[model samples]
Target: MIAKRLVIAGVGIAAVLGGTAVVLDQVTAGQSADSRSAPVAGSSPTASGSGADPGTADAATAAEAGGAATAEATGAAAKPAEGSASAPAGREVLPAVSPSPSGLPMPPPPAPLISLPLPATASAQGKIVDGFPADVIAFPEGTVVVSTGVSSAEGSLQISADAIAASSQASVVGHFQQILGPLKFWSEPVQAAEGQQSMRFSRGNDSVTLTTSTTGTGSTRFMLLANLHAAAGG
Candidate 1:
């Protein structure tokens, strides 16, 4: 009885071991087949993680990572450059300052131009003199008479000539003094050359002036002024 029992138990043990081996072989075969059919690394990913193959999930993960990297690259390319973002659109940048061509600082603008005024063509007093004691001075013969008119109204007269003689000037002065003779005519001293003289004489309501000066070529210039005020209530 003991021997039979031992033989049966041994057979049962063998059967169990054989079945376990077969089960293990089948599981290994199934795993190999699944591996062969599984998605490769770097393939598209699945939406779901549950029950997903590690290889497939890994491929999906790698693909996602690569896509993110590619997206980053593309965005970097599209983004504006550092200075471009700050620059104004459609406008060119100009230099803040321009240098002088001479390389020195630009000269201050030229000082405002100014000019002196010239005298008018005609004399200011309008040649107002007359009855000039030609006896006092006379122009040299043939001296060009550029102008030959004297003007007077009331008690004033002026005369001018382009050329004259000093001797004639002295003679005329002596004659005038002799003719004026001593009538209480108050006189005002006036500066004059040796042969030329100016005097103003006043007597109550009457006054007279004898004035003279000479310029280039001894052009004789003289003025005579006389005022005989009406006697009181006359």
Candidate 2:
């Protein structure tokens, strides 16, 4: 009975030691797992930290990618407006015009008429002492005569002729008679030269002495004569 009691006490002491060893091993394993799972206070984890979650890291990476893409799109949208603002302003374009020529049409000139010269014979013998060739006479037979005379204040008359022809007396006398009406003369024809004639006429106190002669022939022939003191003081 004493030996059986001692054996039972030793078995009890062995079972208690085994159980304590098992409990110590379990506590050590739990301490190792806790150290691996928990982060240290006030310490940042590295990229390779065992405490970091893969899912959380992937979500952070996706957020960063989305931010970059948004930035790029914003820049693209603003690029066109910036480019247009920096460009130059537009202008209205027009073509250049030139001047016209100065050359144009103009007007024409005028016509010229015939004029006769004054005589010198009357100026030498008259009181007024100035004379001009008055009328030019032409005959159908081609003769021309230029008459020259002088008149005094006392109604004295001196007449002379520049005969263009010795013939053509009738042609010269006819033309002289035709112009006589305009000269305001009344006269009877009197022979003065071999082929010439003279006429005398008067108006008021004034007297006229005329001498006519032939010159040239045909249409170029004419007669010239003088009427002096026909108009008083004229």
TM-score of each: 0.26, 0.29
> Deviation in angstroms for 140 in model 2?
8.2
- List, residue by residue over 1-234, the lDDT tens digit for candidate 2: 899999999999999999999999999999999998787765447534756666677789999999999999999986776434343457654556787878886533211111223233453321122442234222334323443344433333444444354454555555556765554545576567675567655433333445554434432223233444423434
How far off is residue 224 in model 1, in Å? 1.1
Residue 220 displacement (Å), model 1? 3.8
Candidate 1: give the clashing pairs.
128-157, 128-158, 129-157, 129-158, 136-172
lDDT of 1: 0.53
Clashes of each: 5, 15
Over 4 Å off in model 2, which ranges?
1-130, 136-159, 165-167, 191-196, 204-227, 230-234
Q: Write the per-residue lDDT of candidate 1 for residues 28-109, one digit (tens) a residue.
A: 9999999877766644445232657667777888999999999999999988887663457889787679665876685433
TM-score of 2: 0.29
| lDDT, model 2, position 3 | 98
